[model samples]
Target: MATIYDVAKQAGVSPKTVSRVLNGDAPVGARTREAVEAAIRALDYRPSSAARTMRSSRSGLVGLITGAISRGDGSAGPSGLPDLFIVQAIQRVVAEAGMTLMIADTGGEADRAVELMATFAQHRAEGLIYVADSHQRIEDLDPRGTPLVLANCFDAAGTPAVLPDDRAGQRALVERVIAAGHRRIAYLTLPEGMIATELRSRGYREALEAAGIAFDPALVIEGFADHGEGPRPYIASALDRLLALEDRPSVICCGNDELALRLYGELRDRGIRVPQEISVAGYDDYRVISETLYPPLTTADLNYRGIGEAAARRLLALIAGAPAPTEAEVIGGPVCWRQSVTEH
Candidate 1:
């Protein structure tokens, strides 16, 4: 029930001076600011965000559209809301920046993007962030000139985006594998067209080339991309082909922790002992799979939360009239080593 006028009277300052101190729109003397702050605390004053917006013409609200955060039953798919981590991070960052975040879940439907964005515009959101579950391209979105930044996904029209450094992460993991004495390595990758698949594939080859190992076309195999696809046929086929090669790989690198989990079962069913017959590693480090597996799978962290924070920061800058980035901001995370991988 306390108002700015009450705080101003207690602080012995004009309401405008209290407004300046509260909004930080104009400079105030340190002593005056301290007095106003102390008065606000004493009165438990809560400023009207609407009044501030009316005066400053800033809503102090950011909108986020994501398919990864939903209100449905907790079981969306095998991945089970992978982008939720990113959403939480964005929420935290926006709150810390003194802005409110309005989130709209698309329910895994891309066609709802424009509608959600329109709603955000109606609410006068100062900026927007689109968070994707994985690295990919989003098409046919109408921003209506709202400042927008992407998280874990990119827009084809050169929108500023913050994404995981898939290529660098994969290359670093491969480098570590090589350092562990792995010469012939096999890679089971996600489906062909995904951004993570392409980047990680390039990184695989780059690491091999850097280590003076010839790029063997036979070592790479395409695996399931979506969580719903499951990991049977693709992984089994790839494992069969790899096992038949004259120079069979000493280590197998999987696209993500889910795939690595399936690979462990397949290998065990075939009576192959992990790290004794063949070393295994994975990416994304979904702890349930990576840490709980028999040998504890070695993998790389995707850094989705970091990507969310970065996207929120970039969108805030863009809303303030800063130049948008022409290329994606790539954030890198560390590789995790576990008992699944050994000196091969």
Candidate 2:
């Protein structure tokens, strides 16, 4: 099958021109159009359904590469809700951008991401979106000249990315919890070196300072899971330690919905009540996890869908030889005011 590349060369025009002639997006001079047409016929080139869809639908094809943590909840791998939302949102956006999307979940394996990326190239994906389960520093990740977009990924290199303005989310959620008259807040985090770990931690410190409360490292706890990843073991241990403290906090801030849900469960087991004994808050508005949790989680709706759509658009522009975005785009979040937190 002769590709558009073959036609472009035969017609003595750039591939962009060949694409324009094929998509009918830009007007070609009659001479150029005739040349492209003659080349197309001479080569007996046939456009794939994906290319035809691009012409009719106004969107080229794109690839989404996600890295999951390979967690075990009796499932195939890692689980993170924020990343999930972002992936889902990207799906919606690509559809709107006149493009079709193919996604590969890396399951917390950078190798998987690399392999999937190679596959994406094989399919000639016009652009690529790299989504991480958390904001971990990616090492040795190369997209090989494809227009790249990172979702919730924090890397100085690679292509432009969409990041959650989590610093803001933390600041807002923490301040709101504090203003409700809750003092002695606790932040139970995941292992260090995770992206959200750093950002949300910053939010925790800033919030405490804003409230004129001295930051206490003692009150901070990290959950190191034993049985499985959720909110159970770590929550039980953190709560045990926090409650055992000479001065227990009246509120607790969790790293994510998964951890928060676990904390909520453990707190209930210990006869500690949410928003009554201790106000609790979390991040990531995972649909099922947040909506179905006992107290219903109060969290940030990081608009993953919007970010995905934006990435799709950016990739298309890149494929069309459009100017790349001048700077990194931060996808912001909305606070989902649920009943998990209570005003003091």
The best candidate by TM-score is 1
TM-score, predicted candidate 2 vs. hidden true structure: 0.75
lDDT of 2 at 97: 68
| Tens-digit lDDT string for candidate 2 (1-344) | 89988999999999999988877888899999999999999999987876574456233568888753243232211124545556677787678766788877777666777788888887778788887765555665677777877766656564676667777878888888777787888887766666667777898899889889999997888763445755376578778888899998887877777778777778887888877778777776776778988688887765666666666666666777888776777767777878888876
Q: Using alpha carbons, what is the TM-score of model 1?
A: 0.83
lDDT of 1 by residue, 1-344 (tens): 98889999999999999999988989999999999999999999998877877777589889999876564443322232378888999999999999999989998787898899999998889998888777878794788989988888787688888889999999999999999999999998887777788889999999999999999989898755444655686678789999999999999998888788888888998999998999999998778678899899999988878888899899988988899888889999899999999985
Which residue pairs clash within candidate 1?
none
Lowest lDDT sum, 10 consecutive residues, model 1, at 72-81
lDDT of each: 0.86, 0.74
Model 2 bad stretches (over 4 Å): 1-59, 67-79, 105-109, 156-158, 224-231
Cα-based TM-score, every candidate = 0.83, 0.75
